[model samples]
Target chain A: MAATRALGPAPSKTPDKPTDAAGQAPRRRPRAWRWADIAEFAGSAASALLLTWLIFDRFLPFRIQGVAFFVAWYALTLPIYWLVVRDGHGPVAARDRLASVLVTTGAAVALSPIFLVVGYVTYRGWSVIDFGFLAETMELTGPLSGADDGGLLHSLIGTLEQLGIATLIAVPLGVLTAVYLSEISGPLARPTRLVADAMTALPSIVAGLFVYSIVVIRTGWGFSGFAGSLALTILMLPTVTIAAEQVLRVVPGSLREAALALGSPYWRSVLLVVLPTARAGLATAVILGMARVVGETAPVLLTVGGTNILNVNPFSDYQDNIPLFVFNQIRSSKESFVDRAWGGALLLLALVLVLFVLARLAGGAGPGRRSRRKKGAAK
Target chain B: MTTQESEAPVTGQPVGGTLRGVGVSAWFGARKVLEGVDIDMRAGVVTALIGPSGCGKSTFLRILNRMHELVPIATLGGSVLLDGDDIYGTALPITEVRRRIGMVFQKPNPFPAMTIGDNVMAGLRLTGRKTANREQLIEESLRRAGLWNEVRNRLGAPAGGLSGGQQQRLCIARSLAVRPDVLLMDEPCSALDPTSTRRIEETILELKDQLTIVIVTHNMQQAQRVSEHCAFFLAAEDEPGRVVEQGETEHIFGSPEDPRTADYVNGRFG
Candidate 1:
């Protein structure tokens, strides 16, 4: 810590990352025109695609040819494009273009599924998601009910209440664990951190099974919303602790030192300085942990025992939740049930987005926030 | 200065204390930084510790207020007396020791989240010494730090709104609000511009009348200008840092007793 601090505040100017140390005075490379670069890339892609289609589709004996065609096209285009760029520009430009290509392809591959799911779900469900479908309950409806039959209000309420209980139990425990890991140091810190990391990788269904054994089997209790919350808390704790610890770790040692030097005790300094400074990050951690567990179905399936009707009392009886509701709908053979599953999935996505926006707004400003006060005006 | 006849400056009484260290040695894990360093800081005088980088002048400054022990690997040996009582002794709580001896860091670290007024009163509040006259206290501390005229209208604003110079002055005001007996500054102007540096130098000169001050500075000229007494630290090849010479500022600058001190004062070698 001292060695790094000794280096002083991050340098304002990095000298634009000093260019290669070649002794020769390098000539200024002209920037290729934007349209020319685009034209070059498009031409390369088209030629590669045409060649692949002609050679692979026509000449190959295999009936399954889409994957082979894609592979052949990519393999042929990369080297050919590299040579063309190398001729017009330098080796550095060629390398830069190749890296850009790889990154663009990687991003497209990553984003494809998200777009696919959103579009597919909306296409199947948008017509079914009317005011009545969202506001009423599914208690009277059968598995084969038509489009005008059921709603998700009961499930939505159950989800919100179960999450509330889980948050109440897990957030405090996770925050304390994170504080212990990041601030207080002792012999147990290493082992405690290792256990937390191990727990984070523990299967979500195992959390459900563990809670089922304790709350349902051992205590001789029926399936209830509280059981689901307990399982969710177990799943959420490790994630919240890990993320919160990372946030606390970067709260600048100087702030703590400043408060301690003013005669505040260690805990007091942490409360008045460290925690406040990391508030935004802690909010982010809580959001991430909540998001992870909110979409889980296996835990609720084992513990809560899904119901169709609204039950506001989480402790006394079984209750419906969004993921469990969607899971049950999708498993049915009826087309109406599948459309309901899609509607529930879309609603769940919107809920997460809304929750994130609300959390950010509630966080206000972190302790690291600099002065936002405008220049003093004449009175 | 405001001609308001307000009872503000009394909160920052400018009370001074006599500080003496005898054979102080410090270590971070196995690497010793200060080796048996001895110095005296008398009431209402400026004692400067000047050395090149890695010479442990900053380490010694943190030692005075027991801030050095906050680092887990750091260990200290020998006694530092404040008004004839050992600050490192178990008789007094470490918090009280820190309360009596305040520090201004190399960087102006006014808490970015706190308002200007809150930043000023932060030290007093931390020590649980915040009195009923907090409004007056903030005004006086800022005045003592030579920042009143610039920030008096915007006391409720965030401390970070100030320029680099004003922020350092605000930090000084924060330390002064606790009414400490001694003030320790570690290169307070190193991060500031020339104009801000000159203002801080002026604050040091004026503050010398009421506060016993120990400052660690890398700029030899700064040490000569602000400190009445000067201590030179040098780390010989493969040796921990130790004081080479100590005397009045003029004596150290004009005619240093040791050849090494003379060479350093003349800018021959750090």
Candidate 2:
């Protein structure tokens, strides 16, 4: 066996091992520091410092002024850090957050101009918003000597009358047309929908011209509140129809099935279930339609000629709306007339605000009553 | 079975109110959905209709109550009889037929805007039943549906606020409030979880005493569990659906005469 031993035979003795590693763990290389993180921190700190300096101190002469400016500036900066810097650490970097913040802040700043304009209006208009200013009519046409001689009671009444008639004409017709479009299915429905879409884009001035041509030029009728209402109806119909249709379509199909399964007729289902479900949205639609045509000056100017005195009758003769009254006041050479115009503008704004509040209250009351009734029945 | 037979004669008329179909076919414009089908529904028992999707099980269910009449293009052949009376006869009113035969859909479709109590009272009010005892009827209906205790204090709250099971129970309560002779349920438990499905099955078993029930379901176990009579509808080669076999639930599940029925019941195929 000794003579026949192989050249590469295995060693019988155990190999020597290192003696320095008695129950100790191996060492690891230190991790490389991330420069990007440090760069981001420095960048944020620098931006914050710059914003603080620009806002707190007068570092830039053209910088925004006062607490309003500081509030707005901080409001703009907080979102930038929250949205942009926090998400900017990924592998594929993008400026989406930054762009969003910039767009939103830019829009806020752009719309801020309206606040100043309204502030100026309120400051000037408050002096003329007294009870006497609302109680009397703006029939007087004298110079700037009489301070308590004029008010906008008549013009306010005329505006209400015209808008009310317009709503009466437009809302039912508009809502019915929308219902027909949504529920009735046939070849005729397509053309009807197309006509509604086309009508939606019809210009307010064109609507005025349409009414003027038909009622005034062709029928030999004089400019009156009725004609003005017809013109306003033309402006309001498409708005109501489109909005009501959208609200009606949003009503769940399940509600319809629930009604139909009860063996109720189609009209009964629509009247009871469908209408009640969409009542809140329908009210909103009506308010929006009223708001749209309430401020029309061209139609009123073309159809209902402006008057110095108020005319309550909508049929016989010309009547003055708030817009027409304001136009007449502004065109007059007298300073009192100009002051009355400002007052009338303020009054119109107040009327619209009141209408919006009432609409909101009406909408809120329905759901409240419904929930209360449900609770009563539950018990 | 003896109790059902005895009770059927005491409720207004005798002979256990029968609904029969004879060589009935239906078409949706050019498409032939159901072809030459015949079935008989007996009062006071649960009849299960099992089929795959688009096999016209729902169409057959709808035909019983004349719900298909609402569709402009849907056409029908032959006749459906209720108590040996032709339902499609010119003398009978569709509204009256629907009022007598109430339907519950697959989804738990309680009117979201209405309160639980109002939903239960909907069908009653629609039929001009404005009696002074409406409150009692509403309470009784909800209690019978096993939903009164949970929704007793919130009758005025919107039905939509209830959980899925509660809403399904509420829908059942609504159906029962009308006192219909027959209840047509189209996959009522298909949208429900197992626990909800169990509760609805218990409700169905309880309701079988007062009304005839026809249920359309895809779950074989559910059909076996809840139904007394079972009808298996299978898709044909050229046509869509026809009844393959029907009998007592025990025979259908345990020892069906037809090989196809055995295969389906044993889970070899649907």
Candidate 3:
């Protein structure tokens, strides 16, 4: 036994004694109850029940009752963090963890009203999303004209065309201006940055007015998709440029020096290295610019005079866009037209969501390729 | 072999002539950084510039390739003759000069988004050397830098994934892929570990047979170990940076002609 102890046990054998100061078996930690987590769970359940009751119960208007429920739910959950978790009366591990949960739950409850509004719109708008509603133009004179009369196909096509033209004009100009202001050091960059900052705060209506003064009143060109696209471009250029510039500025200086030191021309370096490094952020900026311009009713009203039929040519005649169609229908006193307006709003929201999803997918794909390459390299 | 004997063949060789700077001075908007500096770099050899921080060793290296002109306010007086032609002549394009003389920064700055292969080929592509087989060149360059086996399978991976030592070797590979006649490295091994430093020192020894290399370093032992010739830069009484002495590395370390060089090499004062 002494020889065995001196040599230690065989490698495959397990130790028989406990390895602790007390020389007894190790004690398992007791799981503690986190009150703040339980409170958040209870609060979410209460909010869901109240929302369900408000929507299904015949005694209350969903709009008013739903909003009130969310308000109360948020108010109740907001203080749980301060009262229970922040006071640290609970177990140490539970305190910090539950505090985060309560705070997040409070924020979610506060934003619940916006979710309710979107749900209501989507629910009411689903009925008009069939093939007939999508394939026909709104040139008919009557309500619920099934398959042969009215559809949003024309407006959809026109909206895409107008936005495309607007992006074509805006993206290049915006990116170049941003690059100049941020990268090139000169006496003019300061003043140009100031102008860009000022332009960021310019009102959308003011942009429309500026475009109207230049392309409409001065040039004697009547309202058309081309003019509207020009107006939207004016509104969106500053936004995209500012966002792109900020993203580009955040790219580490080492990357730039690496490319330049490799004998790459400055412009080539910007094109191949700098641009691809910030491609995700740039894509997000472009999508944001698209979202800003796609729903501008004021500019479309002032520039692209609403037409009942689709006009494929953006430069020549008035064109129909979803937002303009919705605005025109909403102003009419017909209930059927109002329903169409709601449906159009839903479609526009869906379009923006799709763009957002595309931006996210593209961003996801770039980094995925990088990580996959890393894994392959590791092996 | 003696220090003078080892340097004799390099100084006298006529294949690719030596680079010589005479009465060289650099100024940045009326601030003088280097004053009346004169040095000669023997062809196809490693010349180490050893100095304290802010002694303008890096600035002097940049001047060799006309890289200082990248700064809009930077101006230089005097001539840098490369293979008998004046590099500062108005007729020579700055881009062409940089292509023939590549530089690596103090920090290893491989393009973060680019693949290792792409980073190595960056210089060749920029100079429009399209006929060069990219894969072969990449493998050759990485092998020369002693990084081939480590990164061979992951040629498509981002260069930023490498550790600091690997990144520095990648930077050296990038400079080598351009096939420049001269390579300027600014404190290449300062940010690396001992093993990495030893590997780089080996790579430098292997490279000096083919291309002339000028390196700036703060470590005196590294300078003594790797360089065939060494230049000592120090701050003057009133001026900031001037070359005190430059000769064979062994002579400069063993028995220097100047007192300042002896003091610095002996660790008396910087």
What TM-score do all the candidates reach, one by one?
0.88, 0.79, 0.80
Ranking by TM-score: 1, 3, 2
Better of 1 and 2 by TM-score: 1
lDDT of each: 0.84, 0.77, 0.78
Local lDDT at B100 for model 2: 72
Per-residue accuracy of model 3 over A62-164 as CA lDDT, tens digit each: 5455676655555554454335444554557456655665666678769899898789879877776778778878877476543233768778888998899
Model 1 over residues A245-328: C-alpha lDDT tens digits? 999999878878888777777887787678867877898889888987899899999899888888988886788899998999
**Residue B57 error for model 2, in Å?**
1.6
> Which candidate tops lDDT?
1
The candidate 1 chain B region of ten consecutive residues with least summed lDDT is B1-10
- Residue A189 local lDDT, model 3: 80
- The local lDDT score (0 to 100) that residue A234 gets in candidate 2 is 88
Contacts from the true interface found in each model, as a fraction, amount to: 0.47, 0.32, 0.40
Ranking by lDDT: 1, 3, 2
DockQ metric for all predictions: 0.38, 0.38, 0.43
